[model samples]
Target: MTPEEFAATFERIRREVRTVIVGHETLIDHVLTAFIAGGHVLLEGVPGLGKTLLVKTLAQSLELSFSRIQFTPDLMPADIVGTNVVMQDAEGRRYFEFQRGPVFTQVLLADEVNRATPKTQSALLEAMQEHTVTAAGTSYALEEPFFVLATQNPIEMEGTYPLPEAQLDRFLFKVKAEFPTAADLVEIIDRTTVADQPQARVVASREVIRQMLRLAREVEVASHVKAYTARLVRATHPGDPRSADMARRYVRYGASPRGVQALILSAKVRALVAGRANVSLGDLKALALPSLRHRIILNFEGEAEGIDADAVIQNALDETPELEEART
Candidate 1:
């Protein structure tokens, strides 16, 4: 697909989603970016913020299999990745059979993901990273265009297991779902209370989504632009000379290499969606926060002081220059 075609299709999908979703334009954009980038998204918000509704709307707007997994403390790995079971055929022969779980679908919605125990949560690690589920020593490949959109309530920590760092790193972007404005809330109530409720129409196909992913990778990134992304990620480390003052003071660990990968790929998608043939500095800058926030580990002092990862990321962005000066 051409860049313009990609942008048009993206906008169409966004418009379709907006039909049912009241607001949260930024959240929708990040989720769509991750979808086209072939990456997963982690959405953090309180209950009743329409996080689940957003994922469902996206699924309704696309032609793909959708599955919703309501994560809970008692949820198990087998409940998520399927398990081998003994079966009897019509011929009276007994054999082992694998029952596919919700993870087998094209789009998986892990609602309140943190509510599940760590062991149960680890079940998705392999699928998210490799797109394959291994059960009873047998490997099952998930359907193509597999995307996971997980939501967790940030206000409630009781009885919830925090996602491990390794698992957290798997998500390409961690989007914060902000509450709706007064006008948006009024519109939401009107839509829900009235007899006529908005519904999202299917606007894009799996094939078109695949094409968009291909075109996004085809978007060019200049050498200096690539170097700038690398520098931005490097500056997150507290010990690195390139590290910003905020990072050195508040950050315990910097973002991983995957963070850099996410930034570049998302920026490419952002550029394509903006009808640009190549990624620009602004694209990278705009993506730095969502791409690196969850990846950065804060120090105890920073946590005690209630430091925000976004603040530290902004510091890095301010201190990191676009290019290194040439030798005199």
Candidate 2:
């Protein structure tokens, strides 16, 4: 698909998703960015924020298999990656076969992912990064356009396990599901609390989505934009000379190279989805928080002072060059 066509496709997805989810347009945008960038998403929100509904609506709008796995503390890696099973044939010959887990689907919703143990969470990292799962000394390729939409409750929630940084890096964006405005809440109530819940129409096929992903990758990004992205990533580190005062005081460790890569890829996709042939600094700024939120580590002082990652990223944006900001 051309850039213009890709933009139109995203509009269809937005319309379809909004039918079921009343608000949270930013959340939807980040999810779309991850989709085109071939990266997974980590959704953090309280209950009743429509995170689950949004994923379901997204799956419905695309013609692909969708599976939901509710992660629990007792869940094991074998439960997610699947284990070999022994079976007997009609001729009495025995052989072991691999049974695919819920991760095999094109869109996998790992609900309350942090509730699972770290081992179970690690089982999905390979699939998210490589789009394949290794089982029983054999590698099984996942379907094209594989996406893992994992949700997590707030840290205060009991019996929850925090996702390790290594596992967190696999996700392209860590979307925060914000509450709806009063008007949106009223609309939501009118739409769902009454008789009918809005239904989504399938707007794109798996093939069409793949084509759009290619078009997003084809979006041009200038050297200035690339440099600006690198600066944003670097500013997350406390010791970096270019880091802002707030970053030096609050940050523990900066984002890795993967964070910069995710930021640029997401920016390119965002530009294409907006019908732009090239990536702009605006695209980078819009995605900076979600791209770096999971990657940046907080210092003990920052945690004690209740300094969130968003504040540090905002400060870093202020340190970015005006020439780059204007281009965005």
Candidate 3:
């Protein structure tokens, strides 16, 4: 699809989602970007913040198979990826049948994912990264357009397990849902309490979404922009000579190569939405926070001081130049 067509399609889905969701233009945009960029998203917030609702509303606006998995301490790997069952045919021959789990769907909402154990959480790693699930000595290829939009509560909350770094790395964007303003809360109550409840309508089909994903990949990236992205990622490392002062003081581990992938793909989507055929340096910079927030691990000092990841990322962005070397 052309850039204009891509933007139009994206806006159509966004408008359809807004029919039910209240204010959260930024969060909504990030989620949609991850969706079309062919990456997973982790929605983190406290309860009653509509995180789950947003995922469902977005699913409603797409013509793709959607499934919901309510994660708990008891949830298992097989529960998510499914298990083999012994089945008998009419001929009396029994064989192991692979029954696909909710992970097989195009859009999967993993609600309360932090409540699940790390082992269970790890079940989604292969699927999120390789788009395939291995079981019973066989690998099942997930269909195209597969996405895992997981909702997670803050780890400080009761009975929650912090997602491992590996799990966090699987997500392309980590969006935090802020509490609504008083005015927005009132509007929310008004809409929900009335007889005519708001609903989102389907706006894009699976093929259209696939096309957008392909188009996003085709967006040109300048060498300077690529170099800038690498420089930004490296700057997050405390051990790197070019690291930012804040990062060296506050960060223990830097973002991985996957983080760079997240920034580039999401920036491409942003570029497409802005009707641009080439990615600008600003697109990567604008996307740095969400693309790298969960990827960076804080040092003991930073953790004790309760430093926010965004702060460290901001410092890195400040330290890193848009162009590595001037051609002029």
Candidate 3 residue-wise lDDT, 23-84, digit = tens: 88899999999988999999999989888888888877887778999999999999999999
Task: Please write out the lDDT profile of model 1 over residues 134-248, one tens digit for every residue.
Answer: 9988999988889999998784557677899999999999999998999999989999998888988889988888898888888889988988888888889998977999999
Question: So what's the TM-score on candidate 1?
Answer: 0.97
Ranking by lDDT: 3, 1, 2
Off by over 4 Å in 1: 325-328
Between candidates 1 and 2, the TM-score winner: 1
Model 1: lDDT to the true structure: 0.91
Candidate 1 vs candidate 2, lDDT winner:
1
TM-score of each: 0.97, 0.96, 0.97
Q: Candidate 2: where are CA atoms >4 Å away? A: 322-328
lDDT of 2 by residue, 216-259 (tens): 77777898788788778877888877787778998889888999
| Top-scoring candidate (lDDT) | 3
Model 3 has an lDDT value of 0.92
- Comparing candidate 1 with candidate 3, which one achieves the higher lDDT? 3
For all predictions, the C-alpha RMSD in Å is: 1.8, 2.4, 1.8
After best superposition, candidate 2 residue 16: deviation in angstroms? 1.2
User: How many clashing residue pairs appear in each of the predictions shown?
Assistant: 0, 2, 0
